[model samples]
Structure formats: C-alpha cells, structure tokens
Target chain A: MEAEAARPDRRAERAAARRRRDRRGFAIAAASTVLVIGGLTALILTSSGWPAVRETFFNATVFKESFPDVAKAFWLDIRVFLIVEVAVLALGLLVALIRTSRAAAMFPLRLLAILYADIFRGIPTILLVYLIGFGIPALANSDAEGSSTLSWLPTEPVVLGAIALTLSYGAYVSEVYRAGLRSVHPGQRDAALAIGLTERQAMRHVVIPQAVRNVGPPLLNDFISLQKDVALIAIIGVTGEAFQVAQIMASTDFNYTPLLCAAVLYMAVTIPLARMLDRWDRGRVR
Target chain B: MSGTPVIAIEGVTKAFGDRGVLRGIDLEIAEHEAVAVIGASGSGKSTLLRCVDLLIEIDDGDILLDGEVITDPAADPVAVRRRLGFVFQAYNLFPHLNVIDNVTLGITRAHGLGREDAREAARATLARFGLEGREEESPSNLSGGQQQRVAIARAFATRPRAMLLDEVTSALDPELVGEVLRAVRDLKQEGVTMLIATHEMGFAREVADKVGFLHEGRLVEVGPPEQVLEDPRDPETQRFLRRLLEAGRA
Candidate 1:
C-alpha cells in the first residue's frame, strides 16, 4: 500500500516535469511563429500594390531596355566590391596580427586599429561617402592649383564610393578578424610553443587556419552586406551601369519601376549567396 | 648522466596575480632523469615545469637549461622553449591539423626541415606512439587516448632535450591511462629528461627514478620513489599518499 501511494506521487512529479518542458517548448514555438507572421505581414503590406509591383518587377520591355546598362553597372559594382573586400581583408588581417602580437612596436598599430574600428563603426556610411565624394573633391579643387598630385588622383564617384566602402568595412572586418584571433584556444598556442614553434610560426600554422574556419560565416555575411551596400554608390550621381539604366527608364516612364527592378536584381544576386551561407552555417552547427 | 644537467631551476619563484605559485623552487634534473612531481591540485608542480621550459616567466629566480639561463630577461624564450617539450593536463592537440601536421608543425618551422623530411620524422614518431596510418585524422575525431598520444608524439618529434608532462594521464579513462603511460615509459627508456606531474602513484612508483611531493607551492619532499611513496618523512606527504592510495584502491 505504501509503495502504491509513493508510485502515484512519483508519477505526478514526472508529469509535472513533462508539463514544464512542454510549456517551455510551446513558448519557443509560439514566439517563433509570431515573429514569422509579423515579418510576412510587413512584407505583404509593403508590397500590397501587386499590379504596380508586377509592372515594375516583371515587365519584360523595361528589363530588356535596361539590360546592357544594368549589366555594366553590375560589373562595376562587382569590381568595386572585389577590390574593396580584398583590400579590407588584407589590411584587417595585418591589423589583427598586430593586435595579437606581443612586440612593443605593434602596440601603436593595435591602438590605431581599435580607434579606427570605433570611429568607423560609430559613423554613418552615408556620411563617409559624402565626405569622400563631395568634401574631399571640394577641398582638392580649392587646392588644385598648388597640389598636382591631389588634382591628378580622380575623386570621381566610383573612386570615392570604393574608398568610402573600403574604409568603413575595413574597420568593421578588422574587429571580426580580431574576434577570430581571440577565438583560438590559448592551449593550442602553448602546445605549439611546447613543440618548438615560434609565436609567429604557431600563429600562421595553427591559430590562423582555425580562426579563419571559425569566422567563415561572419565573413560571408559581411560580404553579402557589402554587396547590398553597393547601392549606396547611387547617391553620388555618377550614373554607372545600374544607375544609368534606372535613370533612363525612370525618366522615360516617370515611374519608380526602374528602381524596383534594380532592387529585384540585387535580391537575385544576394539571395543565392545568402542561401549558400545558410547552408554552410547549418553544416558547421551540425 | 654523461652530459651536463638537462634542466636546472634555482631560487625560482612564480606567482599569478599576487598569489605565489612557486616560492623559490630549487631543483636539478640530471641528463635523462625521469623525475615525477606528485602533489595536490594547484600545488605549483605544473608551474615549476612551465618555468623550466620558460613557458611561464619566473618572478625572481633563474632556470638553466642546457647550461644556459633560460629565465634571464635577455634570453630569447622562443629559443629556450625550442629545446623543451610540454604536455598539458588537457591534451592541447591542434584540432585543425591531423596528427601528422600537429607533430610536424614545429619541426618544419623551427628546425627548417623540408616538408618531406618533417613528414617522415612525424610519421616515425606517430608510428612509435601507435598512431600509424592515423596521420590524416583530425585530433577531434580521435579518442582521448589517441589524442593524448598524438600530443605526446608531437612533443617527442621535436627531439627536445627535456619533456614536461603536466598530468598527462589525468584526463584519460582508467582503461586508456595505460596506453599514455606506456608511451611515457617508452620516452623514459629513450633517455628523455622528464619532469612529470602526475596523480598516478602506481605509474610513478613503477617508472619514476625519483619522486617529489609539492604542498602549498613548496617542494616538501624529494627522494627515491620507494622512499617517497612507501616511507614518506613528511606528515603532509604521508596524508597525501594515503588519500591517493585509498582513492586508487576504491
């Protein structure tokens, strides 16, 4: 009789535990569902005018007319992105190396990197673009008579856009690389030292490879952000490939159709890359 | 003992954040001596070994390795560390590199061995530690015993004058402990001057030439393994031995 009585109490405790777990799981599921629904509603309301959206997005004539100019602009964007990203990656790595190194000389470089990251991350990218595009050019024009070097270097929209993006993203990516460096286990460094590798050799052979692998997803995400950010270059009125096409179509029809079309083009490029990143992240998690 | 002492620590003091871990540790390890440091956790055995290798900077003492004062502020720590190998309580195998790469990394970089030669040397060392044909396997994929062996192989591959084993077998399963100990015993037979911090009294009794007991950051006792283990003169040493024996028996 005592055993029977205790059995029911034990069963009750187990049921309560199960109920608690179920409640927690349900809460998580409900929260995720609400978030998804909210996002979907926002997307639907923003894109509610289907006919206008369709005309802007799927109109074959508009796409065909803009194709050549859009292709050129797209290529230009790619060039800017590639150059900026490569430069940022190289500089960020160098800064990360300096940040991690014990050498007293690297202390100044480390501080500079920290300051750069703080300043660039704090400022608006638009402000940086304006500063480089308009402010620098205006300042240079004033001094053009005295400084041939300053005058000779083109402050064209493309050049300014590239420089702005590079500086801004370079600062951000340096932090990413720094995080990657920090993620490397101190034990691994000690192990390398024990086996007779110098600090630099240990970093190059053991630490950096692991750090790069660890930061792969974040690095990819940064690349995608940079890709979309190329649109910011449109503000300068340089009218390269994408902008020229958008301007011609918008002017012809006096509609925002061309801008929407360009947005879709961007989605087309970035969506696939984003999906690849998602898959890579999932693989890493598993 | 034909050559000079492989490692000599005199008046070595190490502290972490105002807490002195090694308070003026003075010891000499002859060439090819296998000295075991047995102590409770945080008793400064590990710190003493690290100081000898110049991994941890000494606060106020000098460490002479191969007749050179490694603890000298002017000495290059990297150069000093190149002559000694260390294994940690948690095997610090490079997870990114497979066993072969982990072992060959130092040899290739520090000694300037060509890739083929380094790989060859690494292969031989790995084979000795029963890691043959496992060169391509990542340390993460290997079992704990295998990983520890790979770490040991990595250290031994460098051909250092001395090896410091900081509780190498502590993290292994009881069944797995033998394989690592066997590897250490093999290293001992090869005349590697070793300072091993271990909790395994049986292994220390069986294999160590000398055993030292550390208590509260002090080397409280040092003598032959039988004398230290069986006939401890210090009360703290006896109590520690008793507890360890009881735990092992349990």
Candidate 2:
C-alpha cells in the first residue's frame, strides 16, 4: 500500500509540490505585512511630534492649492532635462571615441579628452553652474571702457544652466562609455581585421555596436540621475522651473507643500524609468 | 608540385619585445597543394601562419603573393588580407551576428557585393557546409563542431586565393574533429591551396602533400609526408614524434 502511494504519477506529484510552495510563500508574506503595520502604528502613537509633523508636511488643503503652479513649472524642468540628456549622450560618446583612438595623430585629441574628463568630473555640479552662469557674462562685461567684444556669447540664465549640466554630466558619462569600449574582447577586433575590414570599418561595424550594448543598463542609471539634477538650475535663479517656483511658494506661504509636490513629480517620472531599466537588466541576463 | 607559388614566406622573422617567436622562417605553397606544420605548443607554427595572413607584422624579410611583394611597407595590408582567408583555433565568429550575417560580412564589405547577392552567396556556402537551416541561428546556439564549420564557411564564401587554418580543431570535442577534417579534405580535393598548422599527426600525414616539423621557432624538417613523419632527420623532430608516439597521438 505504501509503495503504491509512492509510485510516481508525475503530474499529480508536481501539482502537490507547487501547492505546498504557494502556501508557504503566503504564510511568510502575511506575517511580514502584520509586523510592518504593527511597527508603523507603534511609532506613530509614541512620537511626540507626529501631530506637528503632520500639520506642516501633510496638510491636504495646501497640497491641493499648490498642485497647479508646481505642475506647470514641471513642464519646463522636463523640457530642459530632455535637451540636456541628448547633448550629454552625444558629447560623451564623442569624447570617449577620441580618447580611445588608436591613430598616432590622435594623441593630442586623446590628451584633450582626458583633461576635459578629469577637470569637469572633479568640480561639483553647482559650482560649475555658478561659474558658467555668472563667470561667462561677467568676463564679457569686465572690459567696461570698451565695446564688449564677447557680446555674441549667450548670457541667458537657462542656456548657461544647460551648458553647465551638459559639461558636468558629459564627463561622467564618457567614463561609462570608455569602460564599455574596453570590455569588448580583443578577439572580436582580431576577427574583424582578419576578414579584411579596415580599422575604421571594424570599429564602426563591430566594436562600437558591442560596446553600446554592454553599457545600456548603466546609461539608464545616469539618465535617471540627470533627471533629478535638473532641479539644481533653481540656484541660478531660473524662475520658470519647478524647484524655483516651489521655493518662492514655500517662502511666501510658510508651508512646504510645494516642495513636497515637486518631489512627488520627480518620483513620478523616475520610478517608472527605474522599473523599466530593471526589467531590461533581467531580460539581458536571460 | 611546380607552378607559380601562391604564397612564399622568405626568411621571415618576428619577435614580441625581447622574446623571439619566429626566427628566420621560410616557406612556400604551390598551386593546389596542402602544406602542414606540426609542433608542440609555442613553437611559432601559428605565428608563421599569422605572418602569411598579415595579422602580425614580420620583423625581417618578406612574403610574396603571386610574384608580388605583399610585405612591403607600401603594400596595403587590407588589400593583401582580402585575398586570404584565416580561421583561428577558438573559432572567433562574431557573437552578435547570425550565421549568414557572419559569413556574408566579408562578402559585402571586402568583396563589394550587394546585400541580396551576398546573402544568396552566404546561403549557398552555408548549405555546402551542411548548415543550411542553421543560417538564422546565432553562433552561441551551435555546438563547437558546428561553430567551427561556420567559421570555415565564412572563410570560403569570399573565394580567397589561399586559406590559412591555425589549429582549427584544437578546441573541439573528439567526435567533432572528424567533421571539420572532412570539410578540409573536400577543400583539398577541390584544388584549394592551403597552409595549415595542426596538432593532429595522423590527419596531417594523411592529407598533407608535404609536412614540416617546427622546433623552437625554426622549421627543422620539411619534406614529403612519408619522409618527414616516417623518417625525420633532425633530432628535435625525432624526439617530438617520439613523444607524440608515447602519448598515443601518432
């Protein structure tokens, strides 16, 4: 009788095993959810400042009233981010290709690229914004006695901010591209050359394609970061973007709801991108 | 055995920094003949093949193709390599390209064939090598034997003047070795001039018109297969064959 029960009917046995696994998973999830909710309730009840914190940060009416202005300013933030992201990727790739050039004549170009990456990457982003925003215009106006020869240079606050962001972000992204380029196996290059492809053709057809593929996930991380850093433009007094508008609103109303609104908007865009990139990462491994 | 030489390596020498790999090596391949070089690892057999293919720059002397000096500084290595087909021990097929794409890359790029014509030629070549239905599959999906054959097909599709195979079967499973060697045998029967560096002693002896034994960056013995394999004159060649014999490889 015992032997008969043990005799394998494979489908039925597999079904029973799956049911047991599902039940175990459900039990663990239920216990964990209860613990989290219990801990959160205890913390809220025991804290002395909970009411004050709630009144200042989570006022629903303030959230409702501040939503429109914050939402409007967010479009400007999005626009700047889109433009800067494209500029950063293109400039970064150009610098990386030059840095990795194999020709003897490209030594000077390679050195320039190395210096650019090191210098821009060392300085903080806010300092770069301040310097580019105030320094360039100030230099153009420094010669007060004569006609400013550099009048043709851009003095707009938004343009200067975009330039600052691009320069800073470009340096970091170029390193990412360089790492990807180096990760390609030397054997791939050898095979390409052995088949009569010129060095340029080999890089164009074989090396760059593999390099770009390898760097896709890390590129997304840089992109999400660039999206967040768009807020730093508020420092340069670009009053059209969300963070600047939120700062003004908070100072006038003495409520932080506008800042919270801006935070929510940023998370709204970034969380979806992060999740999408996670999916891409999983698919690549499979 | 006597026609205009397809490839001739004249007193070629190469070194990596301080260590000399190929010291004053000379070789010649006549029309429709197979020359095999056999030696232990690191004996410069592969370097000799690489020098002929122009993958490595020779330190001294020159290589000639069809009475033209191809190793001159002015000679375009790209043009010279286009006339030669080379396969490596590891079967370095591009991972991103499918079988047909890999086979057709040289055809389209170097041979200047249009996309449609290159694809047609690639398909016929793949079919000839018993890989007709596998054209669309990535190289990573194939067995080691199949991948090696694809590498051969990629080389043959361009109608190169001569083929250089560097221990093409060294990385394959034992059962897979016969299939690759069979393809080589068919190429020989079809009158392709080939220079092969290999470790398979029995196959080399059976298929090669001439055999050369390399020892320490020099071609120590080179003659007819029977003379070189059956009665090697040099002490290094003798000891090398004796070792292979003791290992049950000869």
Give the Cα error of residue B115 in candidate 2, in Å. Answer: 1.4
The TM-scores, one per candidate, come to 0.88, 0.92
- The superposed Cα distance between candidate 1 and the true structure at residue B14, in angstroms, equals 1.0
Candidate 1's C-alpha runs over 4 A off are: A1-60, A142-149, B1-3
What DockQ results do all the predictions give, each relative to the true complex? 0.73, 0.72
Clashes of 1: 1
* True lDDT of residue A62, candidate 1: 72
Candidate number of the best TM-score: 2
Worst 10 residues of 1 chain A by lDDT: A142-151
Two-chain complex of model 2, DockQ on C-alpha atoms against the true structure: 0.72
lDDT of 1 by residue, B121-154 (tens): 9999999999999999888888899999998988
lDDT of 1 at A96: 73
